[model samples]
Structures are given as C-alpha cells and as structure tokens.
Target: MSVDTATATAPASATTAERQDVAAPSDRARAWLVLLLAGAFEVGYALAVGGSEGFTVLSWSLVAVVFFLLTLYALSVALRTIDVGIGYAVWAGIGAVGAALLSPVVFDETLSAAKALWLAVIIAGVVWLKLADRPERPDDSDRAAHPAHP
Candidate 1:
C-alpha cells in the first residue's frame, strides 16, 4: 500500500539539462492538476484494496499496481521541475505515511504504537537520505551487465 517504488535512471553523465517552455499559465496549472489526479488515484486504490474480497481483490491489486506506477510517473514529471531528492522524499514519505495512517483510519486496521514508532524511524531515515543527496550511485555496472548481480 505504501507503493515503495524506484525510478529508472540513466548514468548521471548521460543526463542532459533540457529546457522546457511553458508559455501559458494553463500548462503550469495542468501540472498541479495531474498531481492532484495522481493523489486521488492513490487514495482510491488504498480504499479499493481495503474493501476488496475474493477474486475482486486480485483486480483491486492490479488497480493498485497501476496506481503506483502512475504515481511514479507523476513524481517523475514533478521532479522535472523539483530537485530529485526533494521530489523522491516527498513522494515516498507522503505515500507511505499517508497509506499507513489510512489503513487504520479508513480500514479499521491496527497500528500498534510499536509499529508506528518503527515506521517513523524509517521515515526519518528517508528524510536523511533526501538531505544527503547521495553524490554517487553504487557501483553496479557489472551487476547490470549480468542478471545474477554478482
């Protein structure tokens, strides 16, 4: 439900600074509009997953999967204008925490105080990673070249 997901990345050197021309306020507004749509989709997904039963649950899972991917897409679009670390931190932070809270509030799920504390610690770690803005990706060229990830 937290939609823990990753973004596809090319080598940092392969990234080029591209210029975008938005001549109209409508375009800017549309960006926010899509963001809202994506959030709405996530909430709907969480609700569906909570309510679903039987084979319907599988369908609901698929819906959640699509919603999660769409969320990543929206985050990518947002990151076009925002810092990658900031955008990633906010997206995952809000989704994970929001989902955890909704599980209890909307679905009558138990959120034991200990579990909540552990989740809080994980969120804090994410915040730290965001602040650090890791300068180098782990060396993974060999891993990428071979499926075994030696």
Candidate 2:
C-alpha cells in the first residue's frame, strides 16, 4: 500500500484554539519560570554593579554586563507569553527584593525594620499578581454546558 505524499507531510489536525487551550497552562508556567530567572539575573546585575564601584572594577563590571544581557533576554522571552505589565512588575519586584535582602551580606549595607517590612509588602504584591494571573477553570456545572473536549 502506497501512502499519500500530501497526507504524510500534513501537520496535525488540531485546531489553533485547541492547541492553545492545551498549551496555555504550560506556556504560562514556562513564561513565569523564565521571568523568575530574569529576576534572579537582575538581582545579580544589581549586586555586581554595586561591587563594580561605578564600573571602575573590571571583573565586577564584566559580571554586571553579563547579568544585564541575561536578564533582558529572559525577560523578553517571558513577555512573549505573559502580559507586559504583570511580567514587568514581577520582574522588578523580585529584583528589588533580592538585591535589597542580599545587600547587607554582599556589601556594607543595612536593612532597617521599615525597609524589611516594605520588602515583605512587595513580596506579597508579587505573589498576589501571580495568583491573579492564574487561568480560571470551568466548574463541573459549566462543564456539562461547555464540554472540555469537543
């Protein structure tokens, strides 16, 4: 039996909507992961810049540059799937919190009680934003009216 060339080369029959529905959760998860990575890189960049002493230190400046590029790339990758406002807020929040929390350990900086409290608030806000972005699932009542898989 000879296989039809057209059929052999054709793509999967899944519709665009079906594919998006199936992939949306995973894509969102991956985007958030990348955004977190970007935030980590941003924190590294911030710390390195501090250590660089206004770019006078070659090694620290180089490290800062590397982190800068990494954070930008990862942030862009994440923004492709996530809303720009939400992604940017989370990224900035993570970077700010990480850098502030680590400053005392990495440098001659101090974290006052007020500063710590505010950081906690920022952390809470970031968590809330992530929660808000969660996709709503259809309840069992709705499932009967609108089937999951058509």
Candidate 3:
C-alpha cells in the first residue's frame, strides 16, 4: 500500500475554508423557501384528511396522501440545510396557523379571538427561533485538529 503523506498532512485550515465555502447563503435561502413549500403542503394534507373522513372519501383521501408525501419530501430536502429544530418548529407553526385559519371556511370550524391571539403567538415564536439561530457552517473540528494560533 502506498501512503500519500503529503495529502494526509495538508493543513486543516484548507478543509475549514472549503466547508465554509460550501455553506452558501443562496443555499440557505433555498432551504427556507423549500421549508415554506413543505408547510403549505402540510396545510393541504391536513385539510384533505379532514375532508376525507378517515379515508371514507376516496378523492379526498388520495389528495391527502399526495400532500402528505410531498410535505415529507420537501421537509427532508430543507433539512439538508436548515436546522432540524428550527425547521420543524417553523413548519409546524405554519401548518397549525394555516389550518386553524382555514378550517372555518373549509370545515365550518370556529376561530375565536383567543385562537387568533394564540396563532399570532405561534408566528412570533417561529420568528424568534429563526432570529436566534446562528448561521450554519462547519464546526470547529478542523480548528481543533490544527490550532488557529499554531
């Protein structure tokens, strides 16, 4: 077996820079957009399921299934870039608020002032979570391998 010592001992800084370059802002933006699309599908699935009456209604049941799969796929794609915790919370918040607001029209459900206030709270929480998140990038493992000062 031939050993490539030169490649093995390449400075860790190069790896760190490469990873940093990989975490592009455009990718993050695309992730957020995909997350939003997933949330929208969530709302669609919820409404379809509700209308399906436990799969008793064939057309609505099919719609629900399609939306459910789409939601999962979109969420998984977004998770490649977005933090799972923040991504999921935001996704759930969007679905919850959207369904709650939409239920009245779709299913003749009720939405009181208290419900509105709670939905607003959920929105605020999602915003707060997003703002609190640190920009994603490679961790300090590379730095640990090769101390910055050294």
Candidate with the greatest TM-score versus the true structure: 3
Across 1-150, the per-residue lDDT of candidate 2 in tens digits comes to 997532332134654333334445667798889999999999999999999999999999999999999999999888766667788999999999999999999999999999999999999999999988654566787678857433
Sorted by lDDT, highest first, which candidate order results?
Answer: 2, 3, 1
Q: Cα deviation of 64 in candidate 1 (Å)?
A: 4.9
lDDT of 3 at 113: 99
Model 3: runs farther than 4 Å from truth?
A: 1-21, 136-150
Alpha-carbon shift of residue 84 in model 2 (angstroms):
0.3
* Better structure of 1 and 3 per TM-score: 3
Kindly indicate the candidate among 1 and 2 with the higher lDDT. 2
Q: How close is candidate 2 to the true structure, as a TM-score?
A: 0.76
Whichever of 1 and 2 has more TM-score, that candidate is 2
Best by lDDT: 2
Candidate 1 clashing pairs? Answer: none
lDDT (Cα, tens digit) per residue for candidate 3, span 1-150: 886532232243444234224446676688789999999999999999999999999999999999999999999888776767788999999899999999999998999999999999999998898776556444688557755412
